[model samples]
Target: MTRALIADANLIKKVQAGEDPIGCVLCNQACLVEDVSNPIISCQLNPDAGYELEPTPKGFFQTRLKPTRLIKNSIVSIVGSGPAGMELAVSLAEAGFEVELFEKDRELGGALRRISNAGVGGVWCRSLTHYLARIENGRIKTFTDNEVLPDDIAQMAERGPLFLATGSVGSSCHSTMSGYHNWISSSDLLKSPLPAHQERVYVLDNKGDHESAWAVETAACFSDEVVLVTADPSPFSRLHKTGDLMPAISRARSLGVKFLTFTEMRAKGDSVEISKRFSPQRELVQDHMVIEVGARESSRLIEVDGNQTRQIFEIGDCFAPRTIQDAIREARCYSRALLELVAT
Candidate 1:
């Protein structure tokens, strides 16, 4: 009748109905059937589910499970709440550790959150929203708009192991001769509204990868003549899969976009000077120029105090620029390593 005793009845019913209930029944108790709908326990055989039941070190659950032991009351501090930091915090909390995540941005999700809101990238926005919801419901604590400095490491070290997952910085072209009225980095372009002009546009693919495609998609929405100029023979070669490249190329083609491979940009009045591979240089006037170069790690925190911190561990783009998948994987591996060290 009650929730605890219902399992017994179910077991007995299963056995009477010509079924082996041994595997189905978890508690080691003899079932006595008083009625088809109800059953009584004749003997309490296994107590504490095959282990000595004791209050965990954290006083959460009374069990000797390995997972519970690895986490009980352990304090973990994670800097940055991007995929890597957030995933690590959630994983640690689920294992029973007290986790606190710090983020510099006003909101979570890092670059993905900001870029996803840009037109034509709504899918990323939706995925990030779903992930943020899970983090909110979990035991992990998030502190936004808090930048972690090197001095902050000492404070976190006193509590538990520290994880640094600061993201990367966008690289922009600082060349003054590159002529264009509007020359903004990809990061800035993704955040701000496009400049007023819907006719001619030029996108410099200095990163030589999927970011080039992203720039093209964004510019295509506003420009009639959008050109993607890249230094690489195959501009999207850095992307891992061909399947991923197909859809982006298809979208650009549908918008009547132009791809200029092995090309470099120079300044020509209010327009851009383009030099194609094995072709004569020509001046092409454009309304906008979006530059998607590359990114470098922002490791200012780690370089403080002449790098005296010995326990310093850098995960995600702060150590090496990488994809979201790589960042999440590194965080998981780092958390597991920390748990193993504490257990021993």
Candidate 2:
């Protein structure tokens, strides 16, 4: 299936010929975000990949009109450098809005910077080279390591709309638990390598997303024993949308990883409390716990000093925790509308 995602007729020809071979970087963000029921597979990085025309109410096909670049001297301020903020900045710039982006981190790419360690060969992240180059050339003004606050938003949005793509923070739900010590955020996995030689590990999988799978899989490699704890009926249940679902599940089981399904963890006392849905609570101990059910929104409404066409928007994970595909698609959709708003 991974190989199937690599093939496209004309794309294959170009790849072989060493032309613009990266027509599809397989970022896996764009093509699959569409609802399975009403599927329209398109590339997140390249708008032309599968998005050119649309059907009208009269059942007639019409070319999707490009945003008309306005001559206004307006500037849009965007917070965060994650997928959503980066894409939105580029889209607004293309539509003739001057963009100023801010990121607290020294570099761009947000969570993807950490994800570079993964096996995807950096091809996908490199797809942003066009816009990243633009930053170097000063087409878009970027301020890395400069954190923007509500007051900053108030001031920036005075010129135009302000968008908060500030991404997310670790979930605080399980933090109040008594035995919540020695746990690492799921984000830790993306950021760095785990220490060697742990005796046992507990992987928390409440959200059942890719991070959960990664946590369990990583723990299995180093720890003597691994246990997956989830409140859902199954482990990595949300992974049915991706190709890694079955392989991850089967591999976990084969690697001596135990499943504690229909169970929830709150306290990490002498023995960790495992609250079961249908029965009495249980307890177990582990050397470390990886909380993969991460990300609470970090954005909040900024009280603009004055209303000078100052619109505020929250996109990507900040709007709500979601997949990279959702983050990109969300930004793209918002960009189209934002262009129209400023054009008028």
Candidate 3:
């Protein structure tokens, strides 16, 4: 049977390689036959060395092998269910670890969710859903809409090593001057309603990032004659490739919004002084001035001493503000380190 299977595989390969007028010869079989149009050959011969065969979908023969590995039981706990947190938990659970994932938001995704709200599609959300499904099917636990305080970390540390994926918060942009009541952070705009606009408005783009551009666009929706001034050469340069900046630029142009590049605003009364990159300094009079900047890491939970009785590791934006890819990569590395320690 083995010899016959190998022979069939070789014949198929030869046929696939453009072998024409091929003929099959079998010995010592009264029922032996061959069909030239769709050749079929049967024979009973000695199996040869260095010969292998696999079954094909059409009841023919091919060559391949299925891969397999062993899974072991272990226990692991992960904090923050952003891409990083969720990815780590899923990977550990799939590797046979009893994994538990915790998230402060009612939803599992973190910054990815917020970005989606900016009219972007949810690619990470779909991927996360698939991973969470696997974890649930494997009996892993997920805690959502729950913040992990310092005490919570200590208790979880008692069970096993605790991995922190707490994520980051918006950075502060407190202007040096007083009574610049118009200054507001991009995060604040995202969480709360935009302030009532005046006839002429000035937006100070401190971050030169995408979220800031988003704030500017939102403000342009209601404000009359919005003027955006940024220290960077272009608006939302950091997130330009993500398709965040193009729409903003296009919308501002359509709405007759004026954009000033490499410019900084010094607000005074109903006017803001502007310093351009390569021109005479001038003042732009406006009723309001809005400031949009970037974010910073919020690692308060991990900062507290004795927060964890065992070894504690920090991952994701909690360490530094970064993309989802960075978060997942860190989580994977941390999980491997934990496995190595446990083995030792």
Tens digit of per-residue lDDT, candidate 3, span 257-279: 78888887665665556788688
Best by TM-score: 2
How accurate locally, in lDDT, is each candidate? 0.60, 0.64, 0.56
Cα miss at 192, model 2 (Å)? Answer: 9.2
Candidate 1: TM-score? 0.62
- In model 3, residue pairs whose N, Cα or C atoms come closer than 3 Å (at least 3 residues apart or on different chains), thus clashing, are 171-295
lDDT of 2 by residue, 1-344 (tens): 43223323356676678854333555454456448676866665654345445321211101112122322576778888877888788777866678899988888877755554333224434555544654565457889989886666657755666788877766555453434666666655554467577788788776776567666767877789888988889888876665556776877887888998898776556456677889975666544654545634444545323334225667787778777666876787777655544445
Best by lDDT: 2
Which lDDT tens digits does candidate 1 get at residues 37-103?
Answer: 6443332211122122332232211121224343455567888877677767766776668888898
Global fold similarity of model 3 (TM-score): 0.61
Quote the lDDT for 44 in model 3.
Answer: 20
Cα deviation of 241 in candidate 1 (Å)? 1.7
lDDT of 2 at 3: 28
- Misplaced by over 4 Å in model 2 are 1-22, 28-36, 46-71, 120-138, 174-184, 187-199, 216-226, 231-235, 246-263, 268-271, 275-281, 286-290, 299-309
Error of 1 at 162 (Å): 2.9
